[model samples]
Structure formats: C-alpha cells, structure tokens
Target chain A: AQSVTQPDIHITVSEGASLELRCNYSYGATPYLFWYVQSPGQGLQLLLKYFSGDTLVQGIKGFEAEFKRSQSSFNLRKPSVHWSDAAEYFCAVGPSGGTYKYIFGTGTRLKVLA
Target chain B: DAMVIQNPRYQVTQFGKPVTLSCSQTLNHNVMYWYQQKSSQAPKLLFHYYDKDFNNEADTPDNFQSRRPNTSFCFLDIRSPGLGDAAMYLCATSRDQGGYTFGSGTRLTVV
Candidate 1:
C-alpha cells in the first residue's frame, strides 16, 4: 500500500531562521508528491507538488520542496521563516497513474518564535 | 474567483443528533472529496464523488454518509454524531490536473 511518513511531530524555529520538514513515501511506482499547509481554523492549502520532470519544485508562500527518487523523499524547505509561516504541514503521495486518492503523512506542526 | 465553498464554518450539534454539512464548488470540477481531520492528526479521506459516482472508503463508518445531488453540490450526513466526531470536515475539488482546491472547512463540534 502507498503511504507517507513525516518523522517530526512538532518543530520550533525562530523567525528569520531556515526551516526543513522531512517526508518519506512508500509506493511501488513513480509517485506524485505534494506538500500542503494548514493554518489554525482554516482549511489546507496546496504549497507545491512534484508530478514529473525537475526534482526541485517551487510553491506558494516562498516554499520549495525537492523530490528525491532514490530515497523516496520529498522534503519541504523554506530559506527564511516568518511568523506567518507557523502552521501544520502535510506531505501526501499518490500513484503516478491510477486513482486520485492521496495518502497523507501524519503532519508536522511548525511553531515560530520571535 | 473559482473556489470550493463549505457552508456553516462552525457547526455545533447535540450528541446523537443527525447533522448535515454542505459543500459547493464553482470550479465545476469532476471530482469532489470529503476529509475528516482530528486535532493534530492527518486528514482522512471519508469519500469522494467522481461526477455522480460516490466512492466510500473501506473504514468509513456506516453512520457517515454522503450525497452528491449535482455536479456542484455535495453533502455529508452524520447520523448520531458522537463526541469523537467533533473535528474539522474539509471539502475539496479537483480536475484531471494534479493538486486540489480546498474549501475553508466546517468545524463540527458535538456537544
């Protein structure tokens, strides 16, 4: 079965610091990976996705992720964190060609401090 | 201005009472999905409608039901909602293109 894993449950980073959230996926074939962010009391918003082509994908809100096929990883990164970036991040994976159902990771909560 | 819209942003219901949550989309996408998200947990897919076809997840409770009356409207019905059912219910829509557009979500609270 296809699944996603987010190792960190919670992470705290000071404002202006860099951020990295790790994600790993298990699938038998090429995967369609995605990163989504959810603010408190709000629905999830898509940050980025990697379907095919370039490994590095850029997304909204200055977020970027790199898809490593060898490691089955799609790690979300932000060079400089802001107070507004504090939210829960989820990594999802779907089959390259099949059902559109997405398997999501447990999610990582990012706490930004000044 | 196309987006997914969920009604009753915050819903409060008595335990064991049935309640309905609604979702509508202006994107006119072929697929609409419902997800249940508990506190600090990943969102779980309850079901989805590809056009008029309803697809339910295997582990979804029988108390939870969905209806897609039209391409633009979808409803989630909870029969005898329990305290455990208090969580955020999200609605999303997508086309053949990758990535889904999610609504603001309905926060369901069973008292």
Candidate 2:
C-alpha cells in the first residue's frame, strides 16, 4: 500500500520568511504527488502536483514542490509566506498508471507570526 | 469558471437521524468522490463514482451510502448520524489531469 508521512505536526514561521514543509512517501513505483491546503472551516484547495516529466512543480498561491525520487520525498516550499498562507497542509500520493486513489499524510499545521 | 459545488455549508442533525449532503459539478469530469474529514485530520475517502459506476472503499461503513444520479450530481446519505460522523464532508471531481478540484465542503454537526 502507498502511504505518505509528514514528519512535522506543526510549524510556526514569521511572515515574509521562507518556509519548507517536509513530506515523504512509500510506493512501489513512480508516483503522482500533490500538496493541498485547507484553511479553517474550509475545504482543501490544491497547491501543486508533480506528474511525470518535471521534478519541480509550481502551484497556486506562490507555492512550489520538488519531487525527489531517490529520497521518496516531495516537499513543499515557498520563498515568502504571507499571513493568509497559514493553514493545514496535506501531502498525497497516487499510483502513476491512472489510479485515482490517493493516500494522504496526517497534515502539518502552519502558523504565521507577524 | 468550471468548478465543484457542495450544498448547505453547514448542517445539524440529531443522533441516529438521517442526513443527506449534495454535490454538483460543472467540470464534466468522469470521477466524483466523497471524503470525510474530522477536525484537523486528513480527509478520508468514503466512496467514489466513476461515470455511472460506484466504488466504495473496503473500510467504509454500511451506514454511509452515496448516489450519483448523473455525471453532474452526487449525494452522500448518512442513514444514522453518530457523534463520530460529525465532520466536514468534502466533494471532489477529477479527470486524468492528475489534480482534483474540491468544493468548499459541508460541515455536519450531530447533536
């Protein structure tokens, strides 16, 4: 079974500071990776995804993630995070050959300090 | 813009009462999914409809059922609400594009 792990349960970062949220996955074959963000009292919104060719993928809200095959990791990063960016983040993995089932990480709570 | 839409942003029901949550999409995607998300937890897949075919997860309880009347609409029915079933119900639609578009979600409260 494919699974995802977000090592950090919570992370606090000052506004305008760079941020990184770590994610690792265990899968037998090449995987499709995704990052999603959920604000309080709201549903999840897709941040970014890595499908095939590009190891690095850019997403909405100035977020980017790099897929490292060797490490079985796809970590999300932003050069500068805004206060509005504070939310819970999830990392997910799906099988490569048209499998729609996605295994998600527990989540990482992001707090933005002014 | 094309998007997924879920109805009744919030719902309140008594324990053991039946409740239904609705979702509709304009994206015309072949897949629609229902997910249960408890407070601060990752969303768990309950079931999905691929076109007209229904697929339920192995662990999904029988108390939960779903209906996808057509490609544009899907409904999740909870036969008996439990305190543990109180959570956000999310609806999503996707294609082969590898990304899913999600609705704002319906937050359910069981009293």
Candidate 3:
C-alpha cells in the first residue's frame, strides 16, 4: 500500500522566517508526489507536484519542494513566511502506474506569527 | 474557467435525516472523487467514479452512497446522517490519476 507521512502536526513560524514542512512517502516505485494547501473551510489548492526528471519543483505562492529519492522525502519549503501563509498543508502520493487512486498524508498546520 | 464545483457550501441537517450533496465539473475529467474531511484530520476517500464505473473504498460504510449520472456530474448521498457525519465533503476531478483539482467543499453540519 502506498502512503504519505507528514511528521509535523503543527508548526509555528514568525513572519519573514524561512519555512520547511517535511513529507515522506512509502511506495514500491517512484511515485508522483504533490503538495497542497487548504485554508479553514476552503477546498485544497495545489501547490506543486513532482512527476519525473527534476528533483526540485516550484509551485504557486512562492512554495518549492525537493524530491530526494534516497531519503524517500519530498519536503515543502518557502523562502519567507507571511502572516497570510497560515494554513494546513497536505502531501499526497500516487502510484507510478496502475490505478490512479491517491493516498493523502495527515496534514501539517502552520501558524504564522507577525 | 474550467473547475470542479460543489453546491451548498454549508448544509445543516437534523440527525438521522437523509441528505444529498452534488458535484459537477467542467473539467471533462474521467475521474471524480468524494472525500470526507473531519476537522483537523486528513481527507478520507469515500469513493470515486471513473467515467461510468463506481469505485468504493473498502472501509466506506454502507450508509454512504454515490451516483454519477453522466460524465460531468456526481452526487453523494447519506442515507442516515449522524452527528459524526458533520464535516467538509470535498469533490475532486482528474484526467487520469496524477493529481486532482478540488472544489470548494460543502460543510455538512448534522445537528
């Protein structure tokens, strides 16, 4: 079974500070990884995805993630945090092939302090 | 713009009452998914429709049902909603399986 894990349940960072949220996936092969953000009472918005080729992927809202094959990790990073950046982040992974069902990780909630 | 749309942004229903949530997409995607998200928890996949075939997760209870009449519409029906059913229900669309485009979810509140 494919699974994604987000170790952090909650993270607090001051405004203008750098941020990184860890995501690890367990799968037989190299799976497609994604980062999504959701505000309270709102639907999820895609931040970035890693299919193949590049190890580093850039996404909307100045977010970026690196896919490290050795570590089995794809951690989301932001150069600088903003007050409005507070939200829940989820990491999802799909099989490299076969059925397209996706597995979602328990999300990490970020609280930004100004 | 092309997107997945879920109706009734917020719904308040009495316990044991049946309620239906609707989802429609302009994305023309082959896959439509229903996810139940409790507060401060990950979204749990209830089921999905791939074109015309219905795929239900093994852990999904019999009380939860889904319908996809056409390529662009899907509905989730709760036969008897309990207080535990109060949560946000998300509808998503995908071309294949790489990723999904989600709609602003419907918050179901069973009182």
Candidate 4:
C-alpha cells in the first residue's frame, strides 16, 4: 500500500526566513506526489504536484518542491515565508495509471512567527 | 469557477439521532468521495461514488450510509450519531487523474 510520512509534526519559522518541510513516501511504482495546504476551518488547497517532469515543481503561494526519486522524498520549500503562510500541510501519494485514491500523511502544522 | 460545495458548515446532533450532510459539485467530475477527519488526524476515506457505482471502505461503520442521486449531488447519512462519529466530513471530486477539488467541509458535533 502507498503511504506518506511527514516526520515533523510542528514547525516554527520566523517571517521572511527560509522554510523547508520534509516528506517521504512509500510506493511500489513511480508515485504521483502532491502537496496540499489547509487553513483553519478550511478545505485543502493543492500546493503542487509531481507527475512526471524535471524533478522540481513550483506551486501557488510562492512555494516549490523537488521530487527526489532515489530518496523517495518530495520536500516543500519557500525562500521567504510570510505570516499568512501558517497552516497545516499534507503530503499525499497516489498510484499512477488513473487511480484517484490518495494516501495522505498526518500533516505538518507550520507556525510563522513575526 | 468549477468547485465542490458542502452545505452546513457546522452541525449539532443528539446521541442516536440521524444526520445527513450534503455535497454538490459543478465540476462534472466522474468521482465523488467522502472523508472523515478527526482533530489532528489525516482525512480517512469513508466511501466514494464513481459515476453511479458506490464503493465503501471495509472499515466503514454500517451506521454510515451515502447517496449520490445524480452526478451533481451526494449525501452522507449517519444513521445513529455517536460521539466518536463527530468529525469534519469533507467532500472531494476528481476527473480521472486530475487533482481533487475539495469542499470546505461540514463539522459535526454529537452531543
């Protein structure tokens, strides 16, 4: 079964500082990777996805992620964080070949400090 | 914009009472899914409707039922509300391999 692991449960970052959130996935074949953000009392918003490409993917809200096949990691990063960026982030893995089912990680709660 | 919409941002029900949460979509996606998310936990898949076919997860309680009358609407029915069943119910839709479009979700409270 495919699964996603986000080792960090909580992360605090100062505003305007660089940020990185680690994610690791387990899948048999090439996995469909995705990053989603959920604000308090809001639905998830897709941040970015890695289907097949140059390994580096950019997303909305000035975020980016790199898919490392060898490490089975797709970590999200931002050069400069903002206070509004504080939210819960989830990493998900799905099977290719048209399977829409996704296995999501527990999620990482980000706290942006001023 | 094409989106998924869930009604009643919050709902409160007494123990053993029946409650229904509704979801509708304008995206015309072929798949609709229901997920239960407890506090500080990831969303768990409860069931889904692929066009007209219904698929339920093995661990889903029998007390939970769902109805998808047409491509545009889906309803989740909880036969008997329990404290453990109190959680945020999320509805999502997708077309084939496309990314999912999720609704704001309905937060259920069982008293």
Question: Each model's TM-score, in the order given?
Answer: 0.97, 0.97, 0.98, 0.97
Per-residue CA lDDT of model 3 for A46-98, tens digit only, reads 99999999899999999999999999999999999999999999999984337
Off by over 4 Å in 2: A96-98
Second chain TM-score per prediction?
Answer: 0.97, 0.97, 0.98, 0.98
Task: For residues B45-106, write the lDDT of model 3, one tens digit per residue.
Answer: 99988889998889999999999999999999999999989999999999996699999999
In model 2 chain B, the worst 10-residue window by lDDT is B92-101
lDDT of each residue in B43-111, candidate 2, tens digit only? 999998878889898899999999999999999999999999999999999985467889999999999
**Top candidate, metric lDDT:** 3
**Candidate 2, residues A4-81: lDDT per residue as tens digits?**
999999999999999999999999988888999999988889998888998999999999999999999999999999
B66-85 in candidate 1: lDDT tens per residue?
99999999999999999999
Best by DockQ: 3
Could you tell which candidate, 2 or 3, scores higher by TM-score?
A: 3
- Identify the candidate with maximal TM-score: 3
Worst 10 residues of 2 chain A by lDDT: A95-104
Q: Please give the lDDT score at residue A95 for candidate 3.
A: 49
- Candidate 3, superposed: residue stretches over 4 Å from native: none
Clashing pairs in 3: none
Question: Which whole-number lDDT from 0 to 100 does residue B93 have in model 3?
Answer: 90
RMSD of 4: 1.3
* DockQ score for candidate 4: 0.76
Candidate 1: where is the Cα deviation over 4 Å? none
